[model samples]
Target chain A: MDKKLEPIVKTMQEKFSAAHEEFRGEVHVFVNPEQIVDALTVLRDEYKFELLSALTAVDYYPQTSPRFHVVYQLTSLANNVSVQVRVPVDGDSPKVPTAARVYATANWRERELLDMFGIEFEGHPDPRRILMPEETEGHPLRKDFPLGYEEPQFTFNFEEIDLRKPYVKE
Target chain B: MGVEQKLGNMGVVTTTLENMVNWSRTNAMWPMLFGLACCAIEMMSAQAPHYDMSRFGMELMRASPRQSDLMIVAGRVSKKMGPVLRRLYDQMPEPKWVIAMGDCASCGGVFNNYAIYQGVDEVVPVDVYVAGCPPRPEALIHGVLTVHEKVKAQKLKDLAKS
Candidate 1:
């Protein structure tokens, strides 16, 4: 456990009953999906973690119970320290409280999370797809989503590949 | 000075209509300012002082599609950018040529996924395909010269038909 993160973990454990673990000199605090805003607010106001460095999600697909982990990385400029806060949400219709109110940069990160992982950030100021096109149908980052691979053209398969090429003819 | 004086002394030089038109077109091939990804950097480097693209009559990179005669698709074409690429290709006037300059613009490079179009040929007809991850300035110059050669060989009747 980092000495700097010790106080944060102790406060989170006492206040919100959040569980924490340390790995590679970094601390990760696991909090309930609904308690995300509350935990982030406490970290910002009390610990002076004013900068929200990153807000992203990891999809553990095919596992129904709490399948998505929305990870928020916070940085403290004054202390020169950083910590990660993770909130687990159910796979089916995953939803989490918006941290955009606490950190303005979370708005785009939350939008990207929704765009790539299909995890909705409730009460986000502008909830729209950030990376993908507006007409894009599916969340591409999901494990089950197809990669849509196309075979390469080589000397052996040149004729076959050329035939399949979607060339526009006038 | 002697060659210039001799040429000046002669009033006119005769040439075929096809040769004359192809010569003029090849000498002043203005490429459009179209770049999509990292290869765009190489394309710009090709135009810089060291490579000196102006020697081949490609001094001007016109931003408007209407004024350019060549389109150098110089990078990866993402799914979102595919329509825009096609629209730009369509906007160029007749007798225009396309040069796919780099591995990505030529064959989607290493990105064989749903996000990127496999090759730019899927959208527009390519005249010259330069092969390189992001080809060097010399390679781009070679590709430009290849386009010039192709333009030189074009028949007037064939151009009129298109």
Candidate 2:
């Protein structure tokens, strides 16, 4: 609610007039995915929202349109303020531009976003799984992934196999 | 003379021997570092300065199974981690104790997902079950004390037999 940000809001409202408005900030406006990178570059260079606190995607599957939403939370540590920007994308191709140029911390968060949600960061330096093993199929944290797939492959036969017997090679 | 020296000089042979045994056992309770999830945070907190667990002499947390005498299963054991956990239990030396430190560790709490192992006791022999989503630090301390009591009882039984 700073007096200075009044003109910035006016400028966003004037320029991206057709963009679907989800939320607004002291000086910023959340725009569609088409204008997200442009809006971010403006905020970083012109408006000084210099820190990207966190970035992640929320999947809203089975929906007819906009099946995934990428959330970008940026901050101005010096000013102690934050703004959340969400961009809805198609489930088939979840792609977004990397914010590494804007804030260095987005490098890892972008990679996690790609690995976990299957979102592609267009210019991400290293997009890879952060938690799950590379061999692990499907994102385990997703709502749809089955909990325990099948019966275990191994078990002990404590009764049948005699521990008392001398060791013998199989 | 110090209290320990006075106790030694007083000719209380049985009590002195018991104290000596307890002192050594309490000082060397090597706990297995098994952090499964969020409850691991509470486990870390209990180890921090405010709790000062070193006072009762059980602050060493060993990563390897061979060296540890106490296994603190600090969070939910997922189906994936179950076999690995069992392997660790088997690796520990005999006379080792297992502490199921949370509701999840005792009986797979809120994460009733098929992925979670219902109860760790189904796999390993649990000596103490500290019941809570994440048990308070005092509860963990009580669980350790209970383990100490059990150890003392076993020692006394061994002495009686000898």
lDDT per prediction? 0.88, 0.72
TM-score of each candidate's B chain against the true B chain: 0.94, 0.84
Off by over 4 Å in 1: A154-164, A168-170, B1-8
In candidate 1, residue B102 scores what lDDT? 92
lDDT of 1 by residue, B1-162 (tens): 224458677756666988878888898899999888888899999889999899988989999999999999999988888888889988999888999989888888899998988888888888889999989989999999998998788887887786
- Candidate 1 docking band: medium
lDDT (tens digit, per residue) of candidate 1 on A46-165 = 999989998888888888787998899999998889999999889889999898899989888889989998888889899999888899998999878899899887899987877755
Task: Tell me each candidate's TM-score.
Answer: 0.95, 0.66
What DockQ, between 0 and 1, does each candidate earn? 0.62, 0.10
* Candidate 2 local lDDT, B1-162, one digit each (tens): 136567666644345666666656766788887788877888888889998677777788888999999999889887568778889989998668888898988767777665676668767878888999789988888898898887765555565674
Scored by lDDT, model 2 comes in at 0.72
Query: Residue A87 of model 2: what lDDT?
Result: 76
Error of 2 at A90 (Å): 0.6
Judging by DockQ against the true structure, name the best candidate.
Answer: 1
Residue-level lDDT for A38 in candidate 2: 79
